[model samples]
Target: MLAIPVLAAVITIAWAADADIYLESIDKKFFNSLNKIESIFKTWFPKFSFSTEYHIENYQINSLNNESYGLLYSGGLDSLSSYIKHKKETLSLISIWGADIPLNKTKFWDKVKYKVTQLAEMDDIKCYFIKTNVREMMNENLLNKTYLEGEDTNWWLSVSHGLILTSLTSLLPIKTLIMPSSMDENEKVPHGSDLFKFMDYRWADSSLIYDCNLSRHEKIKYLLRGNTQYYQFLRVCYTQFQDYNCGMCEKCLRTITGLLIEGIDPNKCNFKVKNGFLDLIKYYLSNNIILLHSEIAAWEDIQNNIPEESSIEFSFGLKNLILMIIIIKRTIKKEYF
Candidate 1:
């Protein structure tokens, strides 16, 4: 059996749940960094009490190679853009099955794995496949009702995933680890994956690197510059039922709208939209079918990117789509606020 990130992974869940951990041995750097992480998170989320107690017998850490870097590749715009930016460097691509795609969804994961492997191979970068039940390890329903009830979210978003996902790569002998940003650095939305200012979340000497200075709109701009071949593998669907982008879902529609605003075709970006695709997107936006709290900023970014001079006049054009999105955003403010 391979060495797992047992101690590091458990501590992440423990932080949010305020549980006591009894681990015999763990990475020394991880132990040190997590202490700082607790302070950082507490400052960001002052409402919750994260008073986790640790009981460790010994410390076991790994040596570092300063130049080696590993990336958490999800085949999404952010990861793909990150890969494109760092293609010239020595990098390893890591993908986990249980996160985003369910462990039982082997068919979907196999396809994602194969596509990610091809991308790695093309760039002469090494690839690692991880399978873990991290997401399933804790009782979300119980946590949501108790420790996380006031949060209005489960363990995944408000806490757990940032360290949990990064911890899974603890066994990958690299000094620097990279995970793409879901929200921009400026966005005030509180999420588990938001960058920790006090810590890089070191585990076995490896440190997590989060560069969220660029917004989602800015990353999609990278795709427009002849990064075409990789576009076929883009997966931003809201469901694992689809192999690629489901243009109907809010996520897919958001990306579609972003690309459309940037003069990129959705069909070329692995999205197959029907006749009423724009209308469907409008319906989702108007009815609040998707989680709007953390999502509104991205939509606002897309809306702001729509050129004021655009007069395409088509349903999918900036003229109509921006108008619809603006109206829906106003409605969201009235309802959500």
Candidate 2:
């Protein structure tokens, strides 16, 4: 039996659920391949270096033989895109709480669970909900600290999220785990990308990273081809976890921007984008909060896709300059005070 131990939510969830994990038939060659791939990905990021102190604990390996398979669905664009692509297949949809969504807040989680379950049932897919306290165990400030101080962009998810997802398969009854790609092949990074997904799932019978072929904007375009009804069910906002979208947060605004660029009405899809939306985009740029790299790329695509004569025009010129001056003044005042 072989197992690679890591700190992950899946381990905690399995312990909480008393999940039986079997590893006697584990493929040693596949496990080594996963480790080697992980090492190669580590080399991509200058700040990241693979730690060699981790060990395989005997207790972490239990026994299970169920052939169930599914994905870690969050009702977001990437996962939803993958869901639509594989809707016809017999698969289970697993949702985890205590990661992005708080574990104890029943008001928000209950609503999300209900909505997700309905979405699954509509497609005749089995839905499983797992609640965990893994986030509570770690210090958020420390977790947010970049691998190399002042050098690397904060990759909070990349550092440990792949292990968490991979661990879920080993601990649960899931044999095959399909994770949606967060970025396209062009902007490949070490964290949460297809490279990480391919390297992390050594224990599963089949572990695949889906949709590396499409960019974030392209995924939205593909998703729009499907029944647009699922658009209303998207829970992209992390600011207000209880609500579907707050419309003001960076995430909500980014999604709204993409949807609008794709000629889709955000309001019709249940996302309300108020007036002065361009000003908001400027504020984001001034604050250095550009959401995701793909988002920036998507914005450029939006500009290119729309005809120049179209009434809906987007420009990031004067507003951003004015906002930057205001922000600089505010920062100087706070520093002096």
Candidate 3:
């Protein structure tokens, strides 16, 4: 007679265990600061919450005598920069499922992961692949958009991914998890800001944001000094359905531009520059001012490195200007029509 109730209780307990991750006591001052930061984030989207099963109390924090390092690697430029610069100390390369890469798109994940795994192996680092249903669970079983969706839907993964990655450090003996900063110190707070990493450092297992002093452009310059072959596996394209960069997407163009300005051909890498990619590059520069402006800054920095007369057309011509005007007109018409 009591079997049904007993079974239900067992299932409930298992579900909670799976959903929540208990952590050591967090500092009271740090805990209060974390709450304030979270409150500010909540202002952007009131419906979204960063709260999870992160335990904080007055208990003493423990530390191992031997220090180990891990990094949150996504095979993207920022993470790749962090991984490569700190390759000597990085014992673990952690990649999460359904963060930016979609779980349903196994083809993309498989191909990217295979290449990244090979890169990790070359450096003798243990690559850890973690699969989670976090994204699907947050999608709310709807064909519609979630709270995190905005101008660029993929910027933030709805949850505090920094927190998620730090929480996992509890399972390991890692003393520090190096997280790559995506934006410059001067730029406005984007979706996944360094603030989250700072909070994770205080609350979750010890983690530090790597080289926030430099911008994306500066990182590419640092990468230029390293073996280009090491970064050939860098995968920045998210819109394309393939393993290789389509070379026309915003991310691809932005990254390829960085390489081009440095006198490196995108084709030599995993990026397959689309037909008339130069025209598309000009289009993005003229239209997407904010993103392209940063790329231009990178270009200016490497102007001396560029050959006097290179095949790559890093210029804005009259033809590109006309196309930009036409695109704007069409966009306006569509909006009003």
Candidate 4:
């Protein structure tokens, strides 16, 4: 591992000495070192301006100002909605292969590419779909090996995407990265040390991005105000491939369930899916998945009831207990079981 200091920020890079290293390069240690580096930089450079952009390489980056912004695109409803709603501003869309929801037995690549092109045309904006050698980078960074050794592929994928996005930002002029947030985390959910620890490890890791800035209400407002058709096109399921969503999968369940509580019919979505989706509502209510944050918020909205103090504390206690159980199980199993 080579530690390179840039502007007082210590950047650590793990080099592959052997044939090829995958996922293993980005381990807990690497992320920890990254946090240390970011801490140092924040102390020194209190205020910094950066821009975001996407391109095949780092071409034409110099033409952009330091304040210009860019966003990650997956041709999903979130990205599409944001693009259409923020059309007045010049935004660049960055894309990577295999980072989106998995669509089975479908030519989703073509559909996604078409969607990007169509969005660019309709919005009269410039969209850049840059393909990163993610697999290769992971191999070089040895993150692939780490992921293979680790059981949490979903978590690793988020880390991989974060590293790639951060690297892209370094190559561009952007200093801040925007991500979607849920109202549960921001308003209703009770404050707990465990919750903060989880978020700090996942979303607050600076190695994943320069400065990750998530806007919960802003994203909701954007979706509410933007093109309704565009919002309807957001795809949440990754396990199905039939042009529309499966609606039964975890992602679909979360999205549809949230929309249901928000008084929106899932059927109105461009993506078609199974009907008995409501059956899974109970399951979602029971499961402790992260996406449930939005679902809970939607539920509160539907009931038109503010979360009582006891209800908030109960939710937090439940989440914390779930986390503790998970940790205990993983420790006993010696894996992310």
TM-score of each: 0.85, 0.72, 0.67, 0.52
Candidate 1 residue runs with Cα over 4 Å from true position:
1-4, 16-18, 44-51, 149-152, 183-189, 223-225, 311-337
Q: How far is candidate 1 from the true structure (C-alpha RMSD, Å)?
A: 3.6
- Number of the predicted model whose TM-score against the real structure is largest: 1
2 or 4, greater by lDDT: 2
* Alpha carbon lDDT of each predicted model: 0.70, 0.58, 0.55, 0.40
**Residue pairs with backbone overlap in model 3:** none
lDDT of 4 by residue, 142-246 (tens): 543432222222223322344444344344444234332233433432221112223332212222222213232334334543345565556656675556577
Clashing residue pairs in all predictions, respectively, total: 0, 4, 0, 21
Q: Write candidate 1's Cα lDDT for 1-337 as tens digits.
A: 0223675566655666578988777667777777877777776555456877777788776665556888888888888888877767688898988878877888878888998988877777899999989777777677666555453455677677777788788767777888887555445545677745445666665667785657788888754446877777677784645457767768888888787666666777788765577578768766777665556777767655666654433433334555654554565556644
Question: Model 1 reaches what TM-score against the true structure?
Answer: 0.85
Q: Which regions in candidate 3 have their CA more than 4 angstroms from the true location?
A: 1-33, 39-66, 140-159, 196-200, 203-205, 286-337
Give the per-residue lDDT digits (tens) of candidate 2, residues 198-285.
Answer: 5444552445544455666677777653467787677778887656778887768767766765556677556766666666766766
For candidate 2, the lDDT comes to 0.58
Alpha carbon lDDT of residue 17, candidate 3? 30
What's the C-alpha lDDT at position 165 in model 1? 82
RMSD for each of the candidates: 3.6, 8.2, 8.8, 12.9
- Candidate 3 lDDT over 136-193, as tens digits, reads 5433323114344444333233235544444444445566767776554333233434
What ordering of candidates by lDDT runs from best to worst? 1, 2, 3, 4
Winner of 1 and 3 under TM-score: 1
